[model samples]
Structures are given as C-alpha cells and as structure tokens.
Target: MSKRLKQLTKNADKNFNQMIIGVLIVAIGIFLWADKNYFFWPPQLRLLMNSEWSDIVFICLGICLLFTALTGNRSRKFQSILLILASAAVAMLLAEQVWHVLGAHKVEMIMAVILDAGLLTLLIRCAYKN
Candidate 1:
C-alpha cells in the first residue's frame, strides 16, 4: 500500500478504537444509572444489576478480547483461543445468573439451556471463521 493509504488506514483504526471505547463508557454509565434507579426490575434484570466478582472478570476479559479483535495484533490461533475462553466465561456467567432467577422452574431451566447452547455455538463459529 502507498504511504498515504497506510496512514489513512491507521487513522481509521484509531478512530474506530476510540469510538468503541466511548460507546463502552456510555454503556457502563447507563447500566450504573439504571441499577441505581430501577429497584422494581424483574428478578433476572435485578440479578444483572448486582454483578459478582466472576461477572466483572468475565466482562473485563470480554473487553480485552474485543480490543484484541479490533487491533488485529495477535495471531489467529491466539485470538481464537481468547475468543473461546471469553465465550465460555460469558456462558458460565449467564448460566449462573439465570440459575438464580429460574432454577426452580423446570421449563425456564430448559429454555436457558437451549439459549446458552445457541449462544456458545454462535460465538465459537464466529471465532473460527475469523
């Protein structure tokens, strides 16, 4: 690529990264605001409002994976591993939260399982494709 084209690509990537960071910050702010105000939210949503240690860790890992994918700095295999690990962490987190809300309901439990399985499959496929 020409020097000008390369410079443009770099600037575009930097802008994209900044945009992603800005969006994440706004999202977190919204989440915190909602958590403080929405006391009467459903049980499932209430569970999300109160994040545990594992949830924070998984969320951080997901952010790291997102940056890695955006920067394209890691090898494909390494990125794939990160993606899989992040996906599993997310699945586990969701399952744990859902369990707290719907564990007693057999039908909900089955639905959660199906949803989790579908999510995991979709994440894995995207990981491998990239």
Candidate 2:
C-alpha cells in the first residue's frame, strides 16, 4: 500500500478504537448511575455487589484477558480471536444480569442466544481474513 493510504488506515483504526473505548466508558458510567439511583437490583447483580471472592476473581480474569487482547503484540488473527472471546464473555455476563433484572421470557432468551451466536460467527470470520 502507498504511504498515504497506510497512514490513513492506521488513523482510522486508531479512531475506531477510541470510539469503542468511549462507548464502553459511557456505558459503565450509565450503569453506575443507575445502580446508585435505583432502590433494587436483580439477585444476580446483588450477588456480584456482595463481592464474593470467586466473582471478583472471575471479573479480574476477564479484564486481564481484555487488556491483553487489546494491547498485546500478537498476530492479528490471534489478537482478534482473543478480543472476540473476551468481549463475548463480558457482554454475556452483563447481559445475564440485565436479563435477570428484566425477568426475561423464553422468546427474549432465544433471541439473545441467536444474536450472540451470529455475532460470534461474524467476528470469527473477520478475524480469519487476510
């Protein structure tokens, strides 16, 4: 690729990463605000809040995996796969809590599962591309 094209692609990727980080920060902020303002939490979230050692360890592991996936000097395919798995784990954990809070019905559960599977497949395919 030409130098100018390469530079543009790099800048685009950097901007996209920044956007992802910004969105994640905003989502966390909203979650914290809601937690503080709301009187009740779902049992699952309450359990997490109660700070069981296992839950804390699991959360730390997930965060570490995410950090490594983002910042490690690994092959693109490897990093992409790691990123996808880490993201899915985190997303599912949060989604489960939300589902509990919402008292999710069967249809909702099925939809979520289908969506997650489809997303996973797409990410895997993208990661494998040259």
Candidate 3:
C-alpha cells in the first residue's frame, strides 16, 4: 500500500474507535431511559415523559461521536465536564436509595447521568487532543 494510504487508514481507525466510545455512552443512556422510573419529569412535561435529560445527553454524545468520526479533533472539554456531573448525580441517587427519602433523588440521578455523559465526551476529546 502507498504511504499516504497507510496514514489515512491509521487515522480512520483512531476516529472509528473514538466514535465507538461516544456511541457506547449514548447507548447506555438509551437503556437508562427505557427503565421508565429513571425517567422523571413534571406533570406538565409528562407528555415528553421519555424525552428525559438522559436522552438529551445521549444525543449530545452522539453528536460528539459524529464529530470525532469526521474531524478527529477532540477539542472541546464541555462534554467531559458534563459526564462527570452526571456520574456524581448517579452516586447521589444510589445513596438516596438507602435513605429512601422520597425526594427527587431519582431525577437527580438521571440529570447526573446526562451531565456525566457530556463530561465524558469532553474528557475523551481532552485525552486525545492534549
């Protein structure tokens, strides 16, 4: 194979891997949404019951993955910060399970996951770019 072709192939492989990771994050969000109880919202917004924050997070992750697939830049860190926040929220919700406060703990968890996913994507970009 030509030298230029080899470089292209290598870059493509890297981009593909990044995209896969991004997609995996989104997939997890999908499963979380499917659980029903995890998806929480106000009665007024109940019509969009399934359209939870986690779903939004998943979409953002998908967008990041798409960007990685196309540009391989990994420039922004916003997504990474978002993911970390989401994970922290999940941790809080899990703790609430033991406490059983009957509060909006589950909602908190969902929000956290969404934030975490975004942070995660940003982290991935940071790792690759700098």
Candidate 4:
C-alpha cells in the first residue's frame, strides 16, 4: 500500500471513542469483580451478584475494548488475532446470555442469535481488512 493509504488507515483505526469505551468497560469490570460500593443514579442501575456470569462477561468485553483501543499502528496479523479473540469472546458471551434467558422466553432467542452472528461477521471482516 502507498504511504498515504497506510497513514489514513492508521488514523482511522485510532479512535478516541474506542479508548473511552475501553476505559469504561475496564472500570466497570473492576467494580464488578471487586464488589465495590459504587452507586448509580437510579437504584435499578445497581448490578446484583446473583451469579458470576456477569463478571465474566464484563471482563471479556473489557478485553475486547482494549483490543480495539490499543491495536492502532500494529501489524495487520496482530490486529487480526486480537480482533478474532475479542469477537469470539463477545459471541460466546451473547450465546451464554441467550441460553440463560431461554427459560424466560420473554425475548426472541433466534433474533438474539442472528444479531450476534451479524456482529461476529462484521468483526471478522474488520479484522481481515487492510
């Protein structure tokens, strides 16, 4: 690729929003894992410790956020691997949530799977993109 093309690609990959989101995800994960006394505006926003699933899910998302936030200027191969791992974790988390909600039957499980599948496909495509 041309020098200008590479520079543009690098700039595009380095998003401030991704970094901010990554920080938030990591902070939330830490709070959940540590069981800190953090409080939200509304009472409903508080996360309960009914199970460990949420803690695992948040950590996975935080890792994905880090991958997205820090992969800038890295080699394409490295970015691809990180993206694949992150996407897999996200997909697995979604699948697990769907499995748990199956008993409720309040939401459409098939739709959730389809949406997650689409997200996985998009992530894979992004990983392989030049």
Give the number of the best model, judged by TM-score.
1
Minimal lDDT window, size 10, model 4 = 36-45
Superposed Cα deviation of residue 96, candidate 4 (Å): 0.9
- Arranged by TM-score with the best first, the candidates are 1, 4, 3, 2
Model 2 C-alpha lDDT versus the unseen true structure: 0.46
Quote the lDDT for 127 in model 4. Answer: 59
Q: What number of clashing residue pairs does each candidate have, in the order they appear? A: 0, 0, 16, 0
**Model 4: per-residue Cα lDDT at residue 118:** 66
For model 3, the superposed segments whose C-alpha errors exceed 4 Å read 1-9, 39-51, 74-129
Against the hidden true structure, what lDDT does model 1 obtain? 0.53
Better of 2 and 3 by lDDT: 3
Which residue runs of candidate 1 sit more than 4 Å off their true CA positions? 1-51, 97-102, 106-118
lDDT of each: 0.53, 0.46, 0.53, 0.55
Tell me each candidate's TM-score.
0.48, 0.37, 0.42, 0.45
Q: Worst lDDT window (10 residues) for model 1?
A: 17-26
- Winner on TM-score between 2 and 3 is 3
Most lDDT-accurate candidate: 4
lDDT of 2 by residue, 80-116 (tens): 5555654555455456545644663434345545554
Backbone clash pairs in model 4 (N, Cα, C under 3 Å; residues 3+ apart or in different chains), count: 0
The candidate with the higher lDDT, 3 or 4, is: 4
- Give candidate 4's whole-model lDDT: 0.55
